[model samples]
Target: METYGVWYHEVTRMKGREWMRRLTLAQKPTPLEPLTRLGELLRIDLWVKRDDLTGDMVTGGNKIRKLEYLLADALDKGADTIITTGGPQSNHAKTTAALTKRLGLHPVLLLSGKPPEETTANLLINKLVGAEVHYFFPRHPREMDDALLRLAEEMKAKGRKPYIIPVGGSNGIGTLGYIDAYQEMDQQRQEKQLSFDFEFVTAGSGGTFAGIYMGHQAVQASSKLIGVSPWLPSQEIKERIIDCIKDARTLSTDSVPLSGEPALEDLSIYDQYIGSGYAKPTPEGMKALQIMASEESILLDHVYTAKTMAGLMDLVEKGVIARGSSVLFWHTGGAPGLFALQERWSEWGGG
Candidate 1:
């Protein structure tokens, strides 16, 4: 197996291809480290893929991986401004704002929900990065897409080239980022002679899970890909992932190949961790965050990673994952969100 660097070079060498459209953003091959004490507690040989360290201090996260491709496509289309949608404390919105600023492109965010009386965490970062933010309470999340399209049209009428990035940037282009990531992980596995029976990640917009799943299929990896949903129902996530996989197949025939369409069974999204609803802190998730912080010195956010950890722990406790099994947890990065939910943290025994 070729190293990630080698594989990346080969893929990018296809200059004219759509899948080749990507900007260099993330620090590649984010360290895959052993979780010794945590593993012992679960009775599993656990490892973590540290995607939290993928970029700049404030902007680092799995979102940057998608932005590398999404933003590159924006630039390629001669877009001077980017229009995207997300929740107020969205990591994707914050990363898009930061990266767009870094590349000298304007960012306009149409955030869902009412504007907060006070801004902090990702919202504060978005402001500091100088993104133009608009807030609305959408009747449905899909309505945000329409809102973004209308905004893009208005921008175009003003003679500005505006690029619209979907919520979570889960499109075919963004999914390519994780396809590359899967190859990178495979290379790492081969280099270290590591084998994991299961690979886990938090699934929100579904693009990340789709990309990873496609990548796993592309590499014929043996591990089962598990997605712990912190938002959306399992069926909804499955549909979105299936759509993304289809889009990814159309985008990257050379890398991922045009295999048959992935079935619903191809996805494994667990919605049990989405307690109370999106972005709301759950007791199990809070406990999971405490466990990670206390045991591994790792911080997980209430909305994503902590819930994912909670799900993983639940599986272990239920004996679904056998003792001594090898597991790989993909840390998608949301530590910054901790500050956004400080009040909730206080309730979790932090003050």
Candidate 2:
């Protein structure tokens, strides 16, 4: 327990639960279902954490889960406006706008991607929710963060209480959402007597992975977390996750000791899956989407989770992971993007 940090006991038990309650958060635990066909294809026992079916704005992605906690914190702090950023067709931005609108708070989206001529599906959805859209043509990643922070500061100067959710809501409180998910999965495993050797997910901002990592430590689950990085280098993702775990531990109570240095599992990220960069889908990703939908009757978006699936398949084929080991693919969800890729699927006999 010595390594659990100073606030460990208070932070882990009632304080963590209390913090969650204060946020008016929705605890929608997603189902952990087995992917029978996918398992057969990979020659492994495969399961999917169906976060895509997360009960929200009509079966939304993993962002909705994080948003439940983050927006709750915003409301708890009496935030009048919610601010966030992502790509033009960002699922996070769209979901934030929807949830903020539902809570009667103004949402401002700062997008760092190509401006749409007719607007993407997510853009139209954001518009419906009355989110003010701001676009910045940033050729670099640092510029995007800078633009978002600068805009938030300007809002503060104007006396607006702006709650800025980081891109994908990948922060401490945001990460707690996945910790809750880990517990949910743990329960499912117990009921079914399932033993997973590892779980796979696509890490965008690293909070999800960090949360799972910490949650595993907390629950004493042996399942290894493998993150397929959609963006950011491996070292950067590892460092960010470490920092998040440190902060989470700092906020936790002393009775829970995460004795080891916060670290990511022995993970592999096939950077090739990121075709042109973030937001652009790869050829293999498109193929994977078609295969998954056709074989498994599941839809995957081009950007985040689909690419992760493609990578997972590749790893399975290459024997990077043992073939027969039980694996869970976190279906992070962004199927709205499939609408934008109609042309790509047209050749594949899209309905």
Candidate 3:
């Protein structure tokens, strides 16, 4: 029942059965540790927000922050079953299943693509959670969305209450998660009297970055917010993030409304890190993953953090981020995704 910061009104006042409520799912204020080894190597004062440690290895990840709000809303509505959709290795879907089961709600996941030959990482976690999963290859992403909606309708006809969560829990309600996260980080900054020149985070479904952006503007923080995309092109990713901010703005005044679609000068999101595409590992991405593991003894997944850290490294070295700058990387906790790409484990330019 304790509110973190600015978004307390934004989150608890949502139109629902329990208007003022939030399920305490993830650990509050994950540690912001200095990356001494990586900092010396990169010639920058590097720090990592260990959001990856928010939960256990199986269910721990950034997704839990968002799910805390979303699942709470579902429970408030008295839903008996929760329906959600995502790719083969969606952290959000895996978190949803694990937590929904914990709350005594049936989790039905509509995952993209046929089941893999070996169920690893998130897929393995999905199975362990005993979630009802259906795999398919949809011609379009919207097709999967439609499938989820139709499935919910069918469940409703069968006298079951189904609560549908969009991919990545990337909605206005879910955006509250990262907003609170950003507030927590700000609180840490004020307490430690540390000033970060650049704050870097993985820009995937857009909600996480948007929420952070919202919180950044709300608190008038001076850290330069940058997003490294693991998916979507530059323009498309910008649009998605803008849409998320807009959605959040509708629910609360904390988010600054864009006037005439202001240029994204404040928000610097780059698609260059995407390398190939989502979930596909690149040489730089793999090398970055390996570097973090070797230098800091911290593991990063090939899908998300690997590329994000890769981009941050390149920017720092290229003098774009400045050599002596203080940098912070938001580790969004998708390391388990490495097991799914087992065949290419050593293909990141390693002998």
Q: Pick the candidate with the highest TM-score.
A: 1
Best-fitting candidate, scored by lDDT: 1
Candidate 1 lDDT over residue span 89-189, tens digit each: 98898888887887788999999888898899999999898999998877655787799999999999999999999989998888888888888888998
* Residue-wise C-alpha lDDT for candidate 2, range 130-229, written one tens digit per residue: 8999888876555766887898898899899998898888877777777777778889888989988878888787778877877777778777777877
lDDT of 3 by residue, 155-257 (tens): 9999999999987888777887888888899889878888999999988887888888888877887789889988778777777777777776665534454
Clash count, predicted structure 3: 0
How does each model score on TM-score? 0.93, 0.88, 0.90
**Candidates arranged by lDDT, highest first:** 1, 3, 2
Off by over 4 Å in 3: 1-20, 253-266, 348-351
Q: Which stretches of candidate 2 lie over 4 Å from their true place?
A: 1-13, 16-27, 139-141, 252-256, 263-272, 344-351
User: CA lDDT, every prediction?
Assistant: 0.84, 0.75, 0.82
Residue 229, model 2, lDDT:
75
What local lDDT does model 2 show for residue 59? Answer: 47
Q: What are the per-model numbers of colliding residue pairs?
A: 0, 10, 0
